[model samples]
Target: MRKWLPLIAVCAGSFLFLLDTTVVTVALPRIGADLSASVGQLQWVPDVYTLVLTVLMLAAGSLADRWGPRRTFLAGLVVFGLASLACGFSPDIGMLIAARGVQAIGGAALAVTGFALLVAHYDGRERGTAISVFFAVNGLGAAVGPLAGGVLTEYFGWSAIFFVNVPLVVLTAVFTVFALGRDTPARRGRFDLAGAAWFALGAASLVHGLTLGGEGRWTSPVTVGALVVSVVAFAAFGFVERRPEPLLDLRLFRDGGFTTLVACAAASTLTFAALVYVSLWLQTGRALGPVAAGLELAPLAVASFLTSTLAGRVLHRFPPRVLLGAGVLLGAAGCLLQLGLAVPAGLAVTGIGVGIAGPATGAAIVAAAPPGRAGMAAGILTTTRQFGQTLGVAVLGIAYQAGGLAPVYVVAAGCGGVTGLLALVPRKQARVTT
Candidate 1:
C-alpha cells in the first residue's frame, strides 16, 4: 500500500475546501432567513467565495512554488478555519460574504499547493493514484453535504455549517504539519503586483458581466463594458507575462502538452457545470428536496472517485489522449442524456458518465505540467475550473430564462461534444503550461 499518510493530509484539505462549496447549498434558505438577505444577497454569498478563489488562485500557486507547498498548505488551513468561524458568526449578509471571500483566499493557497505537492511526492502511476484518492475524499464530502447541511440546519441552525468546518480545519492542519515536517518554506521572493492586479481585475470584470447577465441584457452597456475591460486586462496580462522576471511563465504554452492541459481542465469544469444545472433542474423544477437531489448526483461522484484511482494507476501505458477523449465522449453522452431527464435515473447516469470523464481529463492535464511548475499548472487549472462554474451559471440561467431547460441542455450538449473533439486532438503528454 502507498504510504498513505501524506496523501491523507492532501485529501483532508480538499474535503474541507469543497465541503463548503456544495454542502452550504442546502443551508441557503436557513441562512437567508437568519440573515434577512435578499435573493441577490443570498446568491452573492456563494458567488463571492467562488469569484475570489478563482481570481487569486494562481497567485497562491506562485507563492507556493516560490516558498514551499508545506508552508502554503498550513497557512491556508489556519486561515480557512478561522474564516469559517467568522462566517459562522456573521452578523449580516455583507459580513458573511466578506468572510466567504477570505475563506476562498485561504482555500486558493491550499488547493494549488496540494496538487503540486502530490505531483512532487508521487510519480507516474503512484501520482495518479494519489490524486484520485484526494478527489475521492472530496466526492465523499459532496455526497454527504446535503444530508449534513440538512441535519445541521434542521437542528443546530445554518451556522452549524460554518462551525463544522472549524474542527476539520484544525485536524487537517495538525496532520499536515506532522506529515510534512517543519521545513523552511520556499519563496517566490517578490510579489508581482502588476500581474496580480491585472489578472484579478480581468477575472472580476468577466464575472461581473456574468453576474449581471441574470438580469437580462447580456449585451447592455455594463455587461459589454465589463467584457471590453476583460479583454483589455487580459491583453495587458499577456504583455506582463512575457516580460523578464515574469510572474507567470508563458513558455509552458508552447508545449502541446499545455494546450491539452488547458483544454482538459476546461472540460473537467464544464462537465461539472452541466451537473450543476441538472441538479438545479431537479430541485427547482421538480421540487425535490436536498437529500434526493444530492442522490441524483451521487452516481457521478462514485464514478469519479473510483475511476480517478484506476486512471492514476494505468495512465503511463495508456495514452492520456485516448483516456481523456473516451472520458469526454462519455461525458458528452451523459450530458446529452441529462437533457432527456424526466427521471432521476437519467440524471444519475449522466452524472456517472461525467464523473468518469473528470479524472481522465484531470490526469491528462496533470501529465502536462513539469514537476517544478506543477503548482502553477494546478493553480491555473483550478482557477479556470472555478471561473467556468460562474460562466456555466450565467449561461444556463440565461438559456433557461430565455428558452427554457431544453434549449439550455442542448447548448450544454453541444459544448460537451466540442470539448470531446478537443480531447481527441493528438495532444502531447502533460507538461508545464503557462
Candidate 2:
C-alpha cells in the first residue's frame, strides 16, 4: 500500500504540468481574439509559463538537494493548485499570463524534484521501471492536451482551458497531502542564486526574442536586444556553472553518456514542438479545424508514450548505442516522411513514426545517467529540450508565419534529419549498458 501511494501523487502532478503546456496551443488564437491581445501578448500565454519555469528549475533542484524532495514536492503542489485557480479566474489575458508565470514556478519545483523522490525510495531495475511509468503517464497528459483543449474551447470557451486544470490540480494536491510522508537529507547548501538568476533572465530574454519574431519584423530593436542579451547571458551561465559552488553542476556533462542523453532530450523536445505546428498547419493551412487537425497528429504522441515505457523496460539489457542508433534512423525516416507530408496520409504516417522515437530517446537518456545524478541530468535534458522547442517554434515562425503548413514540415524534417545524423556519430566506448 505504501509503495503504490507515491506513484499516484507524482503521476498526477506530471499529468497536470504537461497537460497545461500542450492544451494551451489550441487556445492561442481564441485567447488573442477574446482578450484583444497583440501578437506579443498572445505569445506570452505560452512564453511566460515556459520562461518562468525554465528559469526556476535549477533553484528547485537545489531545494531538493538541501532540505529534501518530499517537503518541496508537497509545497509545490499547494502553490501550483492556487495558481491554477488564479489562471481560471483571470479577467483578461494579462492576468492569465501573469498567473501562468506563478504556475511555472510551482511546476519547476515539482518536475525538478519529482523523479528524485521516486529514486530515493527505489533502487536498480525498480527505479528504472518507475521512471518509465512516470514518463509514460506524463506523456499521456501531453498527448491528450491539444485534443482536449480544442474540444473545450470550441464547445465551452477559451477560459475552459484553465478551468480544466482545476480538478487535476485539486486531486494532485490532495494526494500529495495525504499519501506522501516526510523525507529529509542531512546534506545541505545555500541556494545558488547567481546561477539560477542567469538561467531565468537568459532564457526569458531568448524566448522573448523568439516569441517577438512571430509578431513583428525580425529587424525590430526589441527582437535584436532580446536576442543579444540571451546570447551573452547564456555564455555567462556556462561559465558560472563551472564555478566551485555552481548552481547547477557543470561537471555532470563530462560523463561519456551524458552528452548523448542531452542530444536525445533536445531532439525529443523538438519533435513535440514540431507536432504543435504541424497540427496547426493541418487545420489552419488545409482548413480542417481543430479536432480534425488534432486527430491527424494523434498517432505521434500515442506511439511515443507506448515506446518510451517499453524501451525503459529493455534498456538495461541493450547497449545504449544500439538504441540511440535505431532512434536516429527512425527519427530520420520520420523526418523524411514529414518532408513528403502534403497530404493527410503523409501526415499520419510521419507523425506515428516520430511518436516511436520518443521512448527510444527516453530509454537511452535514463540508461546513460548515473543514479544519484538523475535529478540534475533530468533538469539538463528538460532544459535542452525546452531550448530546442524554442528554436523549433521560432524557425517554424520564420518560415511560414503566413500559415503554410507544408513549408513548416519541410523545415522540421530538415532539422530532425540533421540532429539524427549527429546522434549516429561513433562513440569511443559505445557499449554503455551492461
Candidate 3:
C-alpha cells in the first residue's frame, strides 16, 4: 500500500489536470446565460485553455527536469488551485477565460511532470502497470467530466464545477507533498526562453486562425493575419530549436518509434474531438438534457477503464507495435460502427481502443526518450494529443456546420482507419534504455 502511494498522488493530480479539459463543455450554456457571452467568447473559454496548455507543455517539462518534478508538481497544484478559485468567482466571460488560461498553465506543468515522475519511480513491468493506471484514470476523468459538470451545474450552478476542482486539487496537493516529499535539485541547464516564445506564438496563432476560420471569419483580415503569423512563427521556431540548449531537443524526433508513437497519440485524440459532436447530437439532435447526454456517454468511460487494465496486463507479452496496431484498428472499427445503427456501442468500442492504444504508445515514447529527457518525451506525446484535439475541433466543427453530424463521423472514421494502417508499418524496436 505504501509503495503505491506515490502513484496515487501522481495519478490524482494528473486526473484533476486532464479533467478540466472537457469538464467545461457541459457548463458552456450556463456560463453564456449567466455572463451574456457571445458565441466566440463561449468558444474561447475552452479553446484558450487548450491553447495555453499545449503551448506551455514542452516548457513545463524542461522546468520539471531543471527544478525536479516534486517542486514543479507542487507549484502547479498551487497555481491551478488559485486559478480555479478565480474562475469560479469571475463575474464576466473575459475574466473566466483569462482565469482558465492561467489554469492551463498550471495544468501543463502538472501533466508533464506528473507522468515524468511516474516514469522515474517505476520501470520494467511495474512501469507499465503504473502507466496503464495513469491512462485509465486520466481517461475516466475526461469521460466523466461532462457528466460531473452537468450534475454540478444542475444542482449548484456552473460555478460549482470550477469550485469542485478547488477541494480536489487541495487534497491532491496534500497527498502529493506527503508522498513525494522535497525536491532534490538536478544539474542546472539552459532554458531557451526565445524558442519557447516562438513555439507558443506559432501554436496560438495557428489555433486562432483555424478557430476564426471555422467560426465564419475566413475572409476576415484578422483570420488571414493570424495564419500568416502562424507560418512565420513556426519557421522561426524551427530555426531557434536548431540551436544548442534549445527548449525542445530536436534530436528526439530522430527515433522512428517515438515519431510513430507521437503520430499514434494524435490519431487517438482525434476521436476525442468527436466526443463533442456526440454530445451535440445527444443534446441538440436528440433533445436530451446535459445530464442525460453525459450519462449516455458513461459507457465509453467504463469500457475504457476496464480495457486499460486488460492492456496493462497483456502488454508484457506483446510488442508495443502490435498492441498499438490492434488498438488503433479497434478504434477505427468503433468510428466506423458509429456510422451505422450501433452508436452507443461505437462510443464504448472507441473507448476500449483508446484504452489500449494510449498507454502502449505513451510507454513507447517514454522508453524512446534519451537519458534525462522523459519529461520532454511525455510533453511531446501530450502536445500531439492536444494538437489533434485542436484540429478536430476546428476542422470537424466546420464539417458539422456545413454537412451536419453524419459527415463528421465519416471524417473521423476515415482518419482512424488511415492511422491504424499506418501503425501497422514495420519499425525497429523502441529504445528503452536511459
Error of 3 at 345 (Å): 0.2
Candidate 3, 94-121: lDDT as tens digits: 9999999999989999888888888888
Against the reference, the lDDT scores of all candidates come to 0.70, 0.67, 0.83
Q: Distance (Å) between predicted and true CA of 48, model 3?
A: 1.2
Per-residue lDDT over 1-434 for candidate 1, one digit per residue giving the tens place of the 0 to 100 score: 33777888888897788777666666666677888987556767767777887888888877777777888899999889999999999999999999999999888888788877777677766777777676566555654565566667767888988898988898898888777655444444566768888988898898788767766767799999998999999889988887754556777678765666566555555555454445556667888765666666666666656655555566566666666667666666666666676434544544454455555555666656554666676777677667766566566656766766776667666776676677677755534423
Tens-digit lDDT string for candidate 2 (1-434):
68868877887887787777677777777777788887567656766776676777767766676767778887777788789889878888889999998987788778867766766666677676776677777667777777887788878887788777777777777778777777765245566777888887788888788777766557899999999998999888888887654666665566645566566556655555665666556555677666666666666556656665676677677665556555645554565666665344543444343444444454455555444444554565556656666666666666666556556666666665566566666654322221
What is the TM-score of candidate 3?
Answer: 0.96
RMSD to truth, every model: 2.7, 3.3, 1.8
lDDT of residue 204 for candidate 2: 80
User: Which consecutive 10 residues in model 3 have the weakest lDDT in total?
Assistant: 425-434
Q: How close is candidate 1 to the true structure, as a TM-score?
A: 0.90
Could you tally the backbone clashes for each prediction?
A: 13, 1, 0
Q: Sort the predicted structures by TM-score, highest score first.
A: 3, 1, 2
Clash total of candidate 2: 1
Winner on TM-score (1 vs 2): 1
TM-score for all predictions?
Answer: 0.90, 0.88, 0.96
